[model samples]
Target: MTADEPTILATSAGYERGKYGIFDMRPGPIHHFAAELANAGEDAKFCFLHQAVGDPENWIGATYAAFAKTNYRASHLQLFPMPNHEDIRTHLLDQDVIWVNGGSVANLCAIWRVHGLDEILYEAWQAGVVLGGVSAGSICWHVGGSTDSYGPELRAFTDGLGWLPYSNGVHYDGEEQRRPMMHKLIGDGTLPDGYATDDGAGLVYRGTRMVEAVADREGPLAYELRRAADGSVTETPLPTRVLKYQ
Candidate 1:
């Protein structure tokens, strides 16, 4: 990835009511986010990857509705369990912005590997495509992160695509178990010292380094968790710029 490559915007939360919900009309920072992503790409070919949903059409319509509000056009491809599908690679490579939807992080990673999408996405990023997402979408870009993909109990997921060399934890304020688990994991050396974001907040990484923290809400924050020499965990709050709705 070049220094001038667009940063990956990973959000902890946004408008995700799924099908039957309005995408472009939903409140908050999504429309602005989508428009910015579309503008950066120069081409508005927005592609959605919803492998975590396990259903091809489950969230595609809603995703399309959301992107339609911007200058871009949207499309979704179902890759889980469909290896023989034609045009899969073409669609992925052609996307100016690839938005990954949230779901089971483990399951999404597993399927992406099976279809070799992990490598494809990395190459796409290297080619200047803007990659962004929420929750599991956010987690997939890190080296690891805390997740509840296996069961109700949250655990460390260390098999991310590794585009970013740190662990990640989403929904920092929305979920009760997330904060404590992220702290314990980094403190115990089970996971690398990494970043965490509150709902509606986003961490922006230019290449592999985090450059800024942003939010849709006024008070929501993002943080960096590090382990001290004495094995205690420290949370450093990052400066955040709250985005205005367009």
Candidate 2:
């Protein structure tokens, strides 16, 4: 219930795996990312949860392993692959950080509700766990998550973990087809209003404070989607390349 009690770092883009240099055990911005979580005072244990089917071989596991080698001193990193409903439990109370990977939001939500993972995550966040995720991982935290590439006729469910009241649309700038697809879906009454993010960008919320941070060392953009007074959907660009080492 206090400000800055838990600092969350959500990345819109997938975790970069190829020698990012941040997790290289050297002094730099990327190293600072690892340090931020590694240097957390007492009561912090990294819980890297991998989502989706191919995550074990994907960038998610690689990213976590890299972080573990350079930062996370904890021994165990939880791995949850596809159909994660049965794995959902209230045991997260013992963790100080929870990181989800990018994957199918529909499947994630389905399994989340079936096994009550949503409530567990909420409890973890309130308990001071630094909660975060990557692409699909970040979008699912919002309300009425975006339904762009998943098909117009097949709409994913609206109810999410509800970490935030608003919904988010990831890869707004990088995905050329997502913007128009989102507008069409919203106009057709398939999806509610939400925000969008660019590749290598982030929309982080630490407690009640929200800040936009870019992941890559170069160009990456973000956007916020809202309904106009005239009932029209609009996309507003967000500031990018604006964060520094802590």
Which candidate number maximizes TM-score? 1
Prediction 1 global C-alpha lDDT: 0.78
Q: In candidate 2, what are the lDDT values of residues 20-94, reduced to their tens digit?
A: 543432222422452354345433455555543334554444554655544444423333444333344444666
TM-score of 1: 0.88
Model 1 residue 245 CA deviation in Å: 3.1
**lDDT values for all models:** 0.78, 0.58
Candidate 1 lDDT by residue in tens digits, 96-132:
7777878888899988888788888888787767788
| lDDT of model 1, residue 118 | 87
Query: Model 2 off-target regions past 4 Å?
Result: 1-3, 6-8, 19-44, 54-64, 74-91, 147-157, 187-189, 206-214, 244-246
State which candidate has the highest lDDT: 1
